[model samples]
Target: MTRGHFDDGALLAARLLLAGLFLGGAVQKAVDPAPAMALLAMRGMPEFLVWPALAFNALAGTALVLGVWTRPVALALAGYAAFTSIFHFQPADPWQMTIFVKNWAIAGGLLALAVAGAGRLAWRGGR
Candidate 1:
């Protein structure tokens, strides 16, 4: 079809994929929050804030997927991802380092979404 239609489709796909990553992680964490909490505690996060973090993930993911106030939602998620990457610093370990890099990459993608927006296919009427 037209270039605009293609771009919108790509944007929609990217938004869905990025949102799915957060949603899946949130679901997994909700299923087993204790381990995540322990990890967060090790990373110096307060025990009281664990549930709030999980809720943030779920709500942010939902908001992104639904394209509701997408730029702001993506900005928040980008900040959260950046904070989480720093919180879990472990540069000496290969797996941890890879994950650290991945987190930053995800943050970058979220920032891009914040700039490009949800496009025309979004529920909130993007264009």
Candidate 2:
């Protein structure tokens, strides 16, 4: 395969990975929202906002997977990931720090996706 083909494949893979993570989290939250709601409460978010946050995660995740409105969706998810990471930033706890770092990496990937878009396998005809 040509270099372009390889690049497209790599981009598609990255998109799938990121999209799957968000969707999986959304599904988990949907299945048992108590944990997620408790987390939000711990973060000092209003109890009412938890449902909207869950819906946003699910819808944006679905959009990412579909590759429609790729750039904006990616940008939104990147911001969401970054925002969520802040709550996990526990300097004294290595495990929590690791999760914070992972979230940052995910945000970075989403930012890159926002710039490059969904390549060659997107519903909006790809980039």
Candidate 3:
């Protein structure tokens, strides 16, 4: 229709895509939390926190997909991304920068969505 409508549509599409990506990962973790936990443990996070982390990811992913508590959910996702990036750091393979970069990129996108409020076409925000 108009420019604003197109912009909102694009924003909503972006948000939904990101949310789907996050939710897919959460579902994978839920289906087999042991491997996710083992990965986290290998990254040096405490064993006790694994379950909580799983729950957080699942809940936050749902929130994002549903456009419920969008800002807070995005912020939480951003925090998770930052934590994961820090946990996955490898000093020897400087060429393997994609791991950290991807996390940071996702974090930035989540943060942007947090600030942008999911736009008007989102499930919760649509006009």
Candidate 4:
């Protein structure tokens, strides 16, 4: 395969991996929202926010997987990752700290995606 082909494949893989994470989170929240709601409440955020969060996860994740409106969607998800990382910032808790760092890493990948566009393997939905 040519360089473009390899690039496209790599981009597609990244998109799939990132999108799958959100999709999985959406499904988990959908299946049992109690945990998420409780987390929100503990953080002093409105429990209702979980609904919109889940919706955004599902919709934006689908958009990410499809490579549609990629730049904006990736940017939004990147912001989402960084913002959500705030919730995981518990220095005394190793698990939370790891997640907080992981969230930043995800955000970094998403920032790259925002700049890279969807590449040739994408649908190219009119742009």
Per-residue CA lDDT of candidate 2, range 3-116, in tens?
498788888888888988988887888788887777678888876766787788888888878778889999999999999997788799899899999999999999999999
RMSD of every candidate to native, in Å, equals 2.6, 2.7, 3.1, 2.2
Per-residue lDDT tens digits for candidate 3, residues 40-115, read 7887776657668767777777777667788888888898898788755776767446777888899999999888
Which candidate leads in lDDT?
Answer: 4
What is the per-residue lDDT of model 4 for residues 23-124, given as tens digits with 9 covering 90 to 100? Answer: 999999999999888878879999999889999999999988999999999999999999999888889999999999999999999999999988878786
TM-score of each: 0.90, 0.88, 0.79, 0.93
Stretches of model 4 off by over 4 angstroms after superposition: 1-3, 125-127
Arrange candidates, best lDDT first: 4, 2, 1, 3
Candidate 3 Cα lDDT to native: 0.75
Over 2-107, each residue of candidate 1 has an lDDT whose tens digit, in order, gives 4498888888888889889888878878898887787788877776576788788889888878788889999999998898886557867888788788889999
List the global CA lDDT of all models. Answer: 0.84, 0.84, 0.75, 0.92
Q: Candidate 1, which ten residues in sequence have the lowest lDDT sum?
A: 118-127
Maximum-TM-score candidate: 4
Q: By summed lDDT, which 10 consecutive residues of candidate 2 come out lowest?
A: 118-127
Prediction-by-prediction clash tally: 0, 0, 0, 0
- Candidate 1 residue 45 Cα shift, in angstroms, is 1.7
What is the RMSD of candidate 1? 2.6
